[model samples]
Target: MTTARPAPPRPTTAALKVPYRRPALLERIGEHPAGIVAACWVLLLAILCLLAPVIAPYGYNDQDLGNVLAGPSAAHWLGTDPLGRDILSRLLYGGTDAFVGIVQVTLVAVLVGLPTGIAAGYLKGAFDAVSSRLADIILALPSLIILLLLFAIDPSARTAAMITLGLLFSPSLFRIARAMSLQASQELYVRFAEVSRVRKGLIMLRHILPTALPPVVVNLSLMAAFALIIQSGLAFLNFGVLPPQASWGGMLQDAQMVISEAAWMMVPPAVAIGSLVVCFITIGDAARDIVAAATTPRRRSRRGESLEVSVGSVDAEESIVVAPSPTALLRVRGLGLSRAASGTEPAAPLVTDLGFELQPGESIGIVGESGCGKSVTTLALLGLLPANITVDRGEVVFDGEDLTTASKSRMQQLRGRRIGYVSQDPMVGLDPCYRVSNQMIETIRRHSDLSKSAASERAIELLRSVQLHEPERVMSRYPHELSGGMAQRVCIALALAGDPDVLIADEPTTSLDVTVQHGILQLLEQIKRDKGLSLILITHDLNIVPALCDKLLVLYAGDVVEHGPTLDVVTRPRHPYTRRLLDCGLHGVERGEPFPLIEGTVPHPGTWPDGCRFRARCGLATAACAEPGARAVRRDGAVIARCITVREGASEAAALVGAVRTIARPVSVIGDDPNAEEADRG
Candidate 1:
């Protein structure tokens, strides 16, 4: 029997003539009208400055005593300065100094600030504290006063002024860079890189720097404008450049004396300053918009007319399971995650007194609006949270092992082997540089005793299992080559490499088009059934839960406000928050009208309400709702909703609570008690 050999790895997307293309810088700038205008102004001024000698009618300093302080005339258009030099010529020549000085100062500042600030942010502690304090002290000193003082100490220290100004300006850059760095440091990719033990420098350069660049680039453009203003101001005060050489500020200073007789003298320099400043500011704004667009994760436009819940077996468990069953594959109790106080900020909780249980083959959907700790809860469970975010009060017992106390090595062993994770964005989840098969093979090899060839075959097999046509062709393609749906499929395959029992998908369908989202969701459902994998789906949209989750966990400001079966919770929401979410969906929407939305936003950490987290937005909130440690009330002897009115079975509350219990009894209710295991067992 002849064995058919696997097809050789197909040509990559690059070789297949589907080369990735990015718009050229000029083209990108031209897309925005403001950027085009600013660019034209900058280019016009730059060309005029560069070719001043060739374009100007006369030398900048050429003195014609006969026509000093002359107004606009045929001989000297834009009029002559007090020195009889052509004003147009002087203006063109003067730009050279301003442009050169600002460029030099900006370059110096960025060079000094970028590394220092990034370092301070990533390597937080004594170095960061000391550097931040020093920067604060430096920024406190007045720039004009400092420049004047430096010039007073030594008049010939003109170059010293440039260096001093650059140094002085660096503190601002440092602050901006540091702020961007801090934000970038918190990015999922950066934290993931740290967990993977990727080199620190590589993490900062590859992951942190790219995300941080947008803000820094915007600041740099604005800083250039500020530099010009300051440079001109100093020159106006005679602290910058010496005469015979005409600077824009010096021209302004000279023109001020003769303004009464020769008003034209001030026009050229004043217009130059004003026009350039406006151009810089405009360009900065345009650049900011461009950078923001480029850096932000693009959400593919939804193609479907409407996004309705996908109904299937995952929507509701058919098996009659009682509450607090002993068959939980993963159990979490008092799972609190927090970030320590920094500077003036108080200790903030990301996940407070959270608890949940995932039964074998059960799919639980953690639904809430953004910032309700759904993602944090996932990270806390997997031991993948950032360094600063501590598991303050939690025990994540998975497969009978408490992961909170697990060593780094032990957690790493379990992460990809027993528990898999699919991140929000597939583009970030898979390294762009590596081919699809390369990442998969590496992952397979990491946890399994598979050789290179076996691992390669295994990767191909995995890709095929995920329903990719021509798996060999896809194996050689990079992340960017695949569409969002295809990339997410690849991520799913990677997550399943170890045949993990539980899959944690964090917004798996986010940023995907509606059609693609349906496909991905269908794929997840298929995989869960085939592999018998328990899934923890974290998403904000309520519609997504009913299709893929057996149970629903409704979170509000880090608190589980309601927990029950997905179908039960959706059809008859016990809590006002749960009902509000359901109302935001298509169920309550009128044809061709705006859908009703939840009124207030989720409360931020450290600002959660005293009693129930959702009380601030709850219409039924009363004086009793303001008290802390609000207890969960059992409704229909199953579903848990944390509300005093619901607990008391008030007349108004009956309408909402009664509707919920009419559908189905809750399989289990995740409650507010820190000792949630004991509470559930009761």
Candidate 2:
């Protein structure tokens, strides 16, 4: 009897709840010994501020004329101040006032800095320019003069003076927030969220803010301490608090007045100021360390919704006869996409009129030099293009559904469920903050009706499938802890979590060493055979395609220059660009003598020629080749090339790429060397 079909998988990037998670910021800060001690010191100061009235022997302004300037005793602990007030009482009250002022400064600074910095980073234009300049002006102003001017306006305007000081100090935090936001905005994970259909607000909260906060905290802590120190200096100069109302700065001013007669009076406020500053500095250092060790996963456990998905199976369709070329798993017809026009910038076509077909159990390679839209096309397929780029005109039909018109939710469901993607750099494929087990298990559980334990088991199976032995140990490690090959294996395992029908490997072996490259290719080949899944491989290397790909599409300037059977295209390349890639070698400009690859670089977008983009570089380019329709040439119901020399399967073009095949070239990258380590299960 025929078996039933499996249930639909859960969203890959959607709703991954950790069985237990670290309270991201606190876990990093609280676990460190230095951080704990620093935090405790700050807490102790807060406690003293809160309980000042209950703990003090007398009120801040209460004077005992009989105990004037008295020494420490049962009646007057820590002696009496110049006004004959209980010095201990005044000190405790000063702590409270100082905390209040510090809080006021910090709150105002953060309020001014965070929004401006985050806005400037995310929204770059006139706003960024204006805000950045405004911050520069603020930073350049004489901060003490500004505070004194505020005091001059109103002698008792304590709040106004503190607010002005806070405003002046904001630029330091602004700079840190802006730098961090700028860097975090460019991270691969943030970009991944964009393409994954994650809401823009959530992207800021989850990815952008997390990275920006640590440094922001560090700068803010130091800024607070600086504010306190400046306030103390101003008070020492007789500019603040106006006496009676106790403040640390005011107390220091009093101590300075009687320093010769009662030197011990100066010690208390001085020690308080110095110790609090030290605590802030220590806390800031701890936060900086947290930022430096970002790869270390937070260990503080948190309760969250269970990510385990519970899917139900349905009966499978009756078996039917399969057609040959008619069963295209994915079809692209006249696919066009481009970047949106912004301000004076006009829209630039990224990938235009791109068409391809993939059958089950088939591999197609999209090859070209850098900037040829090979990667862009794949991003378009998964609805993962950047904010600037949009799908203008295209029909992406996958398993009968038109993906171009699919809802963001539907598109998200399609990603990693039916269509899996592996990026160029394996290191960027995973989030730096999570361990392999956490990421993999979350993905597995989210896509299937499996508990954490069961999902972990599935993850181990996937690791084994990807040729990564010791899956248990590897899963427990973070992304930085893994080697290049191991990370790539983990990435592949992640792609397989949802049991996708198609896998798109985008230059998987770009930076990988020789042995690793060949083994990864062999592993991919093994996967294709075992899973019977279609593959879309994007690469710039002409030599590597034959190892796993059956069909080839040579892209140039977002146009399909040449495409056909891999053997036919590589052996008898119909385009000059394809032939040049074979001639120049892979390194490009580094091979010496004849020089590797093509001499000139790929033309930038919007600067491409009206007819053929390669016309400027092609040796055989003529007037006829510059015609309007010269960019693409038709051959037997397929696009053969965009060149005048449209020869099908010619031996002349084959010799350029084929000669390297007979030699020892394959043993490293494409060839199967017997001594190399092979997958055990395969």
Candidate 3:
């Protein structure tokens, strides 16, 4: 009989929460006063322009000599011009010239500029240099003279003028696009795609364009505002969009003829032109600010309902009801981090169902290959993750306080004061321009109530503790001046500056040589023992785990395959992945012998088979292993292996049949290899 499945645990923040009413319209208006005001004005003008025919009392060109030079009256409001046309009617219809001309010019500019700029930027060399020189020449020429020359050739040619104006605008757009693309091309993902022989057009469209387009879009808005003023000015000079069309400039030209007799004629059209122009300008400014805000880094809000607040209550009446485990100094339960989905792709889990605990002075090594969410997990713990990534559902209890639902201020207080982080690349982590002491002292001052001199002394003391030669000299030196080993040592010293309780070292020795790596690891071990600090060492090299970590957490394809005592897991691994990793390690291999390799690569995100994430690469795959949920066999206290095949033993004949059916990549398995075992039981 099939047993019913248990429901998933509710997120701590979402479990206990009340629904909040949406913000009122006035509250929203108060929050962004300038933006709302500008938006309203633009919206009002657009409505007037769209409904001009219905709103206007009379036709734009209607003439009545009986009311010539009439003042503001019931018959003809705002008086009649020299030609006896209603000024209000003309003012209402005048928006068409300003709106349509700017729209056409901007459209042509984008179509001509966007692709050409992206191509030049991504595929740089002779083409880019030639385009740059041509753009420079065009930009250097006087814009008005250029327009006059075009008008001379075909006077009254509105379409030709717009096309020429668009061509003039292309160079600036091209420059912005090229600059943005150059920066985007250097990203690791773009380089990887290029190495994989992806099409050039696809790379430009997918990778480079998204990053480049925002600034270009902001420029487009500003350009529209500027184009409107230029279009109206040209119309006044009788060189832009023609007379009898109710253009702003044509109205102004007509008003000038009756300036003395009917000064009121120009008031309506002048006010209309100025107000509309100001609205467009305001809109452009607002658009630019929005782009800036979206690009800047800020603390991400919790997207879903919160589960619970901190276990440690601020009030005396609400004391902790559920006591934390004796061994748990830091406990992470149901930890799942994911980037919110965009466009066509669904929300992809970077790391999911991740749970672990760390005791004071205990080191747990998070082992995984690159791109397996090793660094992402560490970032999530410290709340330093990028804007797109967030803690989807989890509870991080540090010293009885729940961090998942903590405010930004609380997270900031905990980050450098209670927790310290050391990254993979020391050079990237350290600023190049500033001397090491400036950065260290600033950090110390920011976190602690130490004077400048006191912070400097603390920095020097920490440097000396890290075994750096001449602490003062090292502090004075810039990051670029230091060697790889020296830079890493300085980084360790900086992490120690705050006197933090928990120290997280994320692949600290990855970039160094063997000797240097050994030194760094030794330093970490020494520091941990001296300070009695809780250390979380994240690395892919399993060899270091036996020496550094007390507990081993083996991660494969973002799934923890096996976790137990470091020595026991290393000597005799139960999971297929854990065993395979041991077989591939260089520990037992002699100088002449080749190391063992797994059959296939780890599956990409969203590509793994259901039930077992490792089933594709596991040699012990069977029909039972392909079932829905992950199965775990408990070995000892908090020690388990997630493998269905391990729990149910199979006969030799059955193993052979299972292997034939579930081979991810076909290869002959030699019987002589003693390590070759069938997909079988625990």
Candidate 4:
């Protein structure tokens, strides 16, 4: 007779009650000189521009013949222009116009160009080709000529020039946006967003757009400087402002006639234009430096403080609770994804007829070799696949909503709220420029209607909940200042900020040291128990699955070959891919024993065979195995194997099991060599 196992202990309330601490943005600002300086300069300029009307003594274009060409004096500081206008007054007024024009033009360009570029880059092929051609045509036209032509026809030259500038600059913006979007689209975070049932727009805005912003922002700054120069150039050419409109460019145009006689006329406005341009360039340079520093990888000293905090107490005897009568939280049925081929042959399907069901609070581990469609499957679920391939036939149902047809806004609402994600590379997943506190706060505020104080408090609590030490201090630090382990923990905290029901962790601890990896896994386990959160853990390492996952899915060449309870799959894998993966985990070996390796590389979908996707790699393949459909064998509960042969002799099965088990034992050192024997004797 079999005895049933005891139920797992409920997570203690004390472990769930994490104390809140306020985030200190000021502390982070103090540490970053470049960011502080750039911010200060921008703030100062904004204030000055706002107060320009109040501070100036006369109208920007006010004239006085008596003060014409006057040198520096108490009433006319820095001297008067040839037109007798107060140089100081004109400079102040000019700044206001420049600021307005720069802001308006840049906003228009970014608003229009960013979306267009992101769309073109992310959705390549015909769309990309058309957009690229259009961008090329627009870029080829001379912006000045277009502005002049529009201004001649329309009286509102300012608007005409602004529009012309936007049209001219948009192509460059699109190119940069597209390039950055393409790069970010490949990131695991983007993949995580896709798999998390997040909408494309939210992923574009929160994940892809933010990651794409660094380069775009850098370009934007340069463009602001360019916009100002272009405005001045237009004014100088007599195309910008008509007479009686005192712009710096207009002043410069008039000063050219009297330069030799009244050199002071040319000096003042020239200096003003040069100084403003210098300020923008300086600010841009500093911003570029800050962005670079933020993205730069730092060598974290081992002596720095560790972020891990112990759970109040861990009960070793606590058995994990496997939810009974589990209901599906996520379901993927008849899913297929494929990329179009170049040659005459039919397009290749990357994922074909893949299906899976995730129950609430269940930890499902996805294990596979590289390029086995594990990541691709997750991406397709999230609607984050690359533009080339299409989701041929499938439905991803989450909380009764079919995710495949979910709108961008709906997906955004679900992401970071109902579903959170932790990626393999935390650094890529995180925004480097943001402090840990800010990132956590943003994540919380994105989904919840929390006040700043409340969001900050929650952010700190999440940092502590993730077992991070010095939670307050860590909150004040940027991503670059934190260690790899610390950053990953911060990422976990960010994911947890929204109190999501499901957390999809894609190799969350891949780059961490062994000790940190174990601690992180423990934190995940502790959190799962406390929150009753479900997890879909995507990992190549099977060693981690036994400790963290209850169910396992083995994928090869984008198909689910074997799936069952974690223990059962690990102990007795029926699929060839599963057997190879298990064999790879066994370390001990006799001298001269042949080390096993999976024979062929994963077949590229473009050249994939018509039969079983894995038949090429299977040693047990026969003529019958070349059939179109997979043979399903059902075992205990829902355990299923999609193989042709599952009725092997008991002895044969035991021999295979014993072979792997013998190799699983650790090797002992023997006194074979003289040096070993001498050392032993000593």
Q: Each candidate: what lDDT?
A: 0.76, 0.75, 0.72, 0.71
Superposing all C-alpha atoms, what RMSD in Å does each candidate have to the true structure? 21.7, 20.7, 11.0, 22.3
- The digit string of per-residue lDDT tens for model 1 on 541-563 reads 87667767998889888777788
Model 2, span 1-682: residue lDDT tens = 2232232222121222224343355655555677679779889977987799898878889999998777888998788877788888888888886777889999999999987887687666897899899999999999888888887877678777888888888888788778878888887887898899998778766777667787787887888789789877776665667766887788777877788888778777888899889888888877767665563343332366232211111111201112224689988866777777642234567776677788888999998888989888898899888889888765788999889889989998999889988887987889999999999999988788899899989999999999998999998899999988899988999998998999999999898997798788888889999999899989887777876798988988777888788866665566778878766544222325554547677765544554567887988888865544454344622445666556444455455545443222433455555642232112
Model 4 gets an lDDT of: 0.71
Off by over 4 Å in 4: 1-326, 340-346, 589-596, 629-637, 648-682
Worst 10 residues of 1 by lDDT: 309-318
lDDT tens string, model 3, 288-346?
54544444343333455332211111121111122357778898766767766532223
Best by lDDT, which number?
Answer: 1
Q: Give candidate 3's TM-score.
A: 0.64
Score residue 513 of candidate 2 by CA lDDT: 91
What value does the lDDT take at residue 545 in candidate 2? 80
> Per-candidate TM vs. native?
0.54, 0.56, 0.64, 0.50
Off by over 4 Å in 1: 1-326, 629-635, 647-682
lDDT of 4 by residue, 35-87 (tens): 56655766676566568789887777788889888888998886787878887
